[model samples]
Target chain A: MKILCNKADLLKGVSTVSKAVPSKTTMPILECILIDATSAVIKLTANDMDLGIQTEIKGTIVEKGMIAIDAKIFSEIVRKLPDSEISIETNDNLQTTITCEKAKFDLAGKSADEFSFLPKIEKDVSINISEFTLKEVIRQTLFSIADNETNKLMTGELFEFSGSTLRVVSLDGHRISIRKIELKEDVESKKLVVPGKTLSDITKIVSGEIDKDVVLSYTNNHIVFEFDNTTVVSRLIEGDYFKIDQMLSNDYETKVKINKREFLNSIDRATLFVKEGDKKPIILDIGEEAIELKIKSQIGSMDESINIEKEGKDLMIGFNPKFLIDALRVIDEDEVTLYLMNAKAPCFIKDEKENYIYLILPVNFNVGA
Target chain B: MKILCNKADLLKGVSTVSKAVPSKTTMPILECILIDATSAVIKLTANDMDLGIQTEIKGTIVEKGMIAIDAKIFSEIVRKLPDSEISIETNDNLQTTITCEKAKFDLAGKSADEFSFLPKIEKDVSINISEFTLKEVIRQTLFSIADNETNKLMTGELFEFSGSTLRVVSLDGHRISIRKIELKEDVESKKLVVPGKTLSDITKIVSGEIDKDVVLSYTNNHIVFEFDNTTVVSRLIEGDYFKIDQMLSNDYETKVKINKREFLNSIDRATLFVKEGDKKPIILDIGEEAIELKIKSQIGSMDESINIEKEGKDLMIGFNPKFLIDALRVIDEDEVTLYLMNAKAPCFIKDEKENYIYLILPVNFNVGA
Candidate 1:
């Protein structure tokens, strides 16, 4: 295969597909990217059985042929090449030569016919959402996904769609995060559990342009996201997601509205007294017009207060500072509301429209202490 | 110890002394910073036997006392404290209370008597140099220090001062780097091998202001650097340094002058074709007008030529591109002269006044190939 492309164009294409290239696998072919030049434009494809990425190169095609080259080496070479036109040619013996400006790299390649291609999934149910909205929802909720592989279901985020609304949810054992967005068009009801790894990678590829929309399709076993010149295919986890609705409730004995920045800063300061392996609990005392934060440990103790608009009864609760900080940081609003049923029950931080919600389990503590 | 200090001032003092606090050590006292408030000014010191740093904290001493506290925790707490006046008080039991704004940290402290103090060094010989020059010389030569622990002497830089001249030299097995500077004042002649670790850490504390000079003193086995309210004491390596003078010679069969940026960039691009465990030699064919760089590997081959002013017979030599790149990147000159003796002898990159010299050993390559 002979193709001439700009160095920048080739680097972009290689990097997009490289996200799916496996660093180590029993099948060596999975480490390579299949370079196909048969069509009007050159296509680069990478697959690791569970995830696949394909992107097109914007350059002239000299001849129609194909080859598979090591993704890591090829990408590095292209990235470091001078900013000029790059020529790539593959011979019948599977030897590839890449030339850019005054630099040339003749690398060993494998036959493209021996490589695995992404599965062809029939477009069953598809939805269109702005790339900006999708990326925002993923970033807001992906952090709560369980990192442990013991429970496969916990490693994925649930995407639930009904009527004209779509909701995304992620929950580890200690905390739960949920984001809801309104769709532009009505679509068939559908639910899919996507691996957190896949959602995070997609966030990297999607552009920040909110005007452009990403077309998403779900098949029986595979889901695809197509936008611009790139397409991503990821396997959907097959299992029942947790009954998250039952865990969330509107019943609360105390509700406090406080400035998001002030609350976040207070929690961050309290963490100073905490050391590695020291699970110190930060206590929050909700009063009539203010919320006080307290942390006592062998190293020291810290206390701070922030003015708040309170409703309902007063209560005190303790929580892991990191969990509270994580939930508050992702919130973009200036003011946030917190609902607490009691010291032992989980507390909820939600928006005015209920578009976003974060529930964190409180750590048990002696109220008198 | 009772003292009132600004948050920023305390943070700066803690960070400077924390550099000497060993991350992991058998001596527990080494993990603490001794705060002495006996004088009108408050002093903070940290020691790890081999090195010690002492700096004065900008604050008012309310009472005369002293205590030792964990360096890691104290630094973190001070850094996160609100931007306001902070008050620290230690009782007879060594329990300390650190209060800033609405936050308070009562940390456990140790007796100041248990902490090891920096030894008082009698000034035997002293030399004065601008902090800017001292920092510059260290940066230009420290990269060549041997990282391996097998040779204790090669891990330090040789500092030689005579008349109004100060020269620093560092040599590993593969390359040697040297820097020479003329001092403004006449100083006593002395020689010391300062550990690479000490030089690097000192670089962090010294400001780049050339107008200010750092007072340096050498005792029996200790070297002290005092500047800008901070003092650093380091134990000099007690051993003979490598004889690097015989290794650098002006006699050369080929001498070529080339643009430093172009030479460095070409070598960086040539490195793309080389992989881990593959020490591919980059061959340089020097001619009358230009120098051709070529690299042939199992993966591929690369060749480029750059314009140069040559003065000797045509010659071919090979070197590890990384070593050449390292020395060239640090050079501030627009054009650099290279002196080559032969294909096997070490090549030298130096200035006209011999203020800076870098000798790199060429990798053995097949001249006929």
Candidate 2:
């Protein structure tokens, strides 16, 4: 295989595919990036069993062949090479030579036949969404996904499509975050669970352009995202997601509307007094005109209040400050409303239209302790 | 103790002194910052046995007293507080109350008497240098200091004052770095070995302003640096420094003048083939008009060349790419002259006036291996 490509173009393609390259693997071949010039465009692919990324770059194909090169070394060399034309050639013995200006590198490449290729997905059912909207939805819900594999479904987010609305939901037993977006076209009802790691990697690859659209195609076992000359394929988590609808409630005994920035800042400050790995909860006392936030730990205690417009009866509730902070940070509105059914029920932070809902379970705490 | 200060001012002072607070120490008092309001200026001090820092912040003293607060918690609280005047009050029982805007914190403070204080240095011998110049000299020579305590003196830098010239030298056994600067006013000849950690911390505190001067005062055992309303006191390493004069040679059989940036870039690219903890050397083959750099490792091999203006007979030498890259990175010259005697002798990177000299010992290598 022989090809001549610009350093900038090659580096970008290498970096895009490198996201799926496993850092440590039992099979050494999984660490290699297959470079194929047989097609009109040079394609670079890296697969790590669960996730795979393939990107193409513009280059002149001197000879049509393929070779798998170590992703780490190839990327590093291309990154540091001069911003000029780079010539990559591979011999029959899989010895690849890279040359740019006055610098030259000779590396041992593995046979491309031994490399694992991404599973081809049949593009039967597909949906088109703007990159900006897709990235925003992922960012708003990805944080709530469970990091551990104890509950396989909790480690993945549920993507449900019905009518003209696409609803994304993620939870980790403690809290549930749901976001609903209007789709441009109507589609049949469908649901799939996507691993959090895959979505995290996809976010990095998308440019988040409002005009550019990403085509998402999914099969029974695999899902594919195609945009900007790059394609990402990830295996779907095979499990039924938790029925979060039962956990969400619309009835409330007390409701309050407060400035999002002020509430976020107060909760953030309260977090300073809570040490890591501690179960200290921030107690909120909703009164007539303001909500007093309190927390007491071994090191210190913090008490802060934010003015709020309240209705119904006043109530006191305790919650993990991190859950409240996470929901408030993603909200871009000037003010957010909070609804509480009672001290034992979960508190809901959502708009009247229910475009977004964040339900946080309350923790039992000694009042006025 | 009671004081009202702007949140920004308090945060700055806390951060400045927190550098001296050890992360883990047997003496808990060393992890606290003593807030002394007994004097006219509100001072915050932190000591870690070997190094101590004290800084004064502008604040109105409501009541004249002193208290000690945990550095980590105090800094975090002050950092998150609102940008307004913060009132800090301490009761007789060492319960400190800090209030800013609508937020308040009650922290347990330690006894001020238990906190360690910085050693007072008599300002009999002092030198005034612009913060920019001092910071530059330290940056240029600090990289050569040995990190390990195997050799007590090698872990420090020699600051020698002779007439109007102030020469600084530091070396690890393989290479030596020397930098000389002309002082504004003539002073008596003196010598002091300042610990690398002290100089490192001083660099972060200094603003590097050309108009601002940092007053450095030295005693028999301590060195004090006062600048920008901040004073840092550190214990100096006591021992005779190595005599690097013999290692620097003026004689040479082959000489080459090359662009500092180009040579540095070529050597840096060659470093890609070298693995961590590997002792692979970059071989330089000086020819009539260019120098070719070559390196071979188990992973791969790299060969690069840079055009140079050469003199005398051709010669080949090898050196650890890191040693050469370190010196080249710190030097500000566009073109540097290299003086080489033979493959066994050291290479000198300096000029005619010898304002800056870097002596690097070459490593033996097989010519065509």
Candidate 3:
């Protein structure tokens, strides 16, 4: 394979595909990136059994061929090369040579026949969504997904489409995060559970441009995302997600409107008093004018008050500070409203438009302390 | 004890003294900071048997007393307090209360009698130097100090004062780094080896201002550095330093002058071909007008050439890329001169003013590779 391209263009393409490369694997060939110059554009692909990424760069193809090279070494060399044109060529024996202005590197490449190609998915059902909206929804919900594999379904997020609305939900048995967005065009209803690792990698690749749209096509077991001359194919998790509707409720006995920044800062300060690995909960005492936040541990105790607009009976509740902090950080609004049914029920934080909802369970604590 | 101080001032004092507090110790008292309000000024002190630091902050003292608190928790609390006047008070039972605008903390404090205090050093002999120059000299020589305690003296830097010059030297048996500066006034000749950890901590505290000066005083076993409103006392290593004078030479058979940045970049690019923990050396082929650098490893090989001005017979030498990169990164000259005697002898990198010198030993390699 022979190709001539700019350093910046080649580096960008290499980095985009490197996200799917496995760091350690039993088969050495899985760590290689296949470079194909058979077409007019140069394509680079990397697959790690579960996830695969491919990207194309504009270059002049002198010879039509393909070869696989070690991704780690190739990326490092291209990153440090001079800001000029780079020439890459492979010989009959698969000896690839890379040359720039005053630097030259000779590396041994493997046969392209030994590499595993991505599974081709039939594009029967597809949906189009802006990159900015897709990235935001993933960021807001991915954090709540379970990291361990004890519950296979909880390790992935549920993506459900009905009529014109797309709903995304993730939970870890302690809390649930749900986000909804309206689609530009109506499509057939479908549901799929995507692995958290795949969504996390996609967020890093997308540019988050409001005008650019990403086309997502899914089959029975595989899904494909196409945008910006790059394509990502990932296997879907095969399991039924938990029915979270039963865990949510609309009835509330208390409602409060408070400044997001003020509440976030107060809860963050109260967290400092809790020791590591300790399940000390932050107790909140809600009243007519303000809410008192308190936490006590073996080292110290902290107490602070924040003013809020409330219209309900006074109540006291305790919760894990991390769950509250995580939800508050992703919210872009200046003020957020909270709906509580009682001290034993889960608290709901959502917008008036029902765009996002975060439900957090309360922990039992000693009120006299 | 009772005192009122601004959040910024208290945080700065706590951070400065916290550097001396050991992370883990057999005696729990070593992890505490002593807050003394016996005098009009509020002082904070921390000691770890080997190093001790104390700093005073401006605050209004309402009561005269002292107590010790855990350094980690105190610093974290002070960092997150509101940006206003903070009142700190303690009861007879050593229960400390800290209050700000709307937040309050209650922490358990230990008796001040159990905390170790810094030993007072008599000002018998001292020297005054600008903070900028002192920091620069330390940065240029500290990287050569040995990290392991196999050689007691090599783990510290030699500080020698003679005539009108203050010379600092450090080495790890392979290479040596030397820096010299002229003092404002001549004093008694003295020699001491300051531990690397103490110098590292001092650098982080000093402001590095050209107009301000730091007074350094030493006795038989301890050295004291006083600057701004802080004082740092450290124990010196007791041993004889290595004899590096014999390792330096003024005679050379080959001389080359090259651009520091260009040479550094070329060597850095060549380093990409070397594997981790490998002893591969970069060979330099010095000609009349340019120097060619080449490296070969199990993975691949790289070759690059850089322009230079040579004034001696052609020679070939090999060296560990890290040693050369370290010396080049510290030198601030646009053009640096290299003096070489033979293929096996050490190389000298210095300036015409003789303010700094770096000696690097070359590695032996197969010439025909």
Best by lDDT: 2
- lDDT for each residue of candidate 3 in B1-369, tens digit (9 for 90 to 100): 999999999999999999899988998889999999999899999999899999999999999999899999899989988799999999999999999988889999999999999998888998998999889899999999999989989989999999889999999887899999999999789999999999998898888999999899999899999998999999999987777787788999999999998888878888888777988999999999999999988788888888899988899999999889999999999999999988899989999887889988999999877
Of the true contacts between chains A and B, what fraction does model 3 have?
0.85
Q: How far is A169's C-alpha from truth in model 2 (Å)?
A: 0.7
Clashes of each: 0, 0, 0
Candidate 2 at A13: error in angstroms?
0.6
Using Cα atoms with residue i matched to residue i, what is each candidate's TM-score against the true structure? 0.96, 0.99, 0.97
- What is candidate 1's lDDT per residue for A207-301, written digit by digit as tens? 85799999999986888999988999999999889999999898888989999988998899889878867788899988898888999877677
Ranking of candidates on lDDT, top first: 2, 3, 1
Between candidates 2 and 3, the one scoring higher on lDDT is 2
RMSD of each: 2.1, 1.2, 1.6
Error of 2 at B360 (Å): 1.2
lDDT per residue for candidate 2 within B3-102, as digits (tens), equals 9999999999999998899999988898899999998989999999899999999999999999999999999999999899999999999999999999
Chain A TM-score vs. truth, each candidate: 0.97, 0.98, 0.98
Q: Which regions of candidate 1 fall more than 4 Å away from where they truly are?
A: A275-278, A366-369, B124-126, B296-300, B366-369
Residue-level lDDT of model 3, residues A156-242, one tens digit each, is: 999988899999999998899999999998878988999898999999999999999999889989888899999999999997888
Rank the models by TM-score, top first.
Answer: 2, 3, 1
Fnat, model by model in order, equals 0.65, 0.95, 0.85
Superior candidate under DockQ, 2 versus 3: 2
Q: Which candidate number would show the highest DockQ if scored against the true structure?
A: 2
Worst 10 residues of 3 chain B by lDDT: B239-248
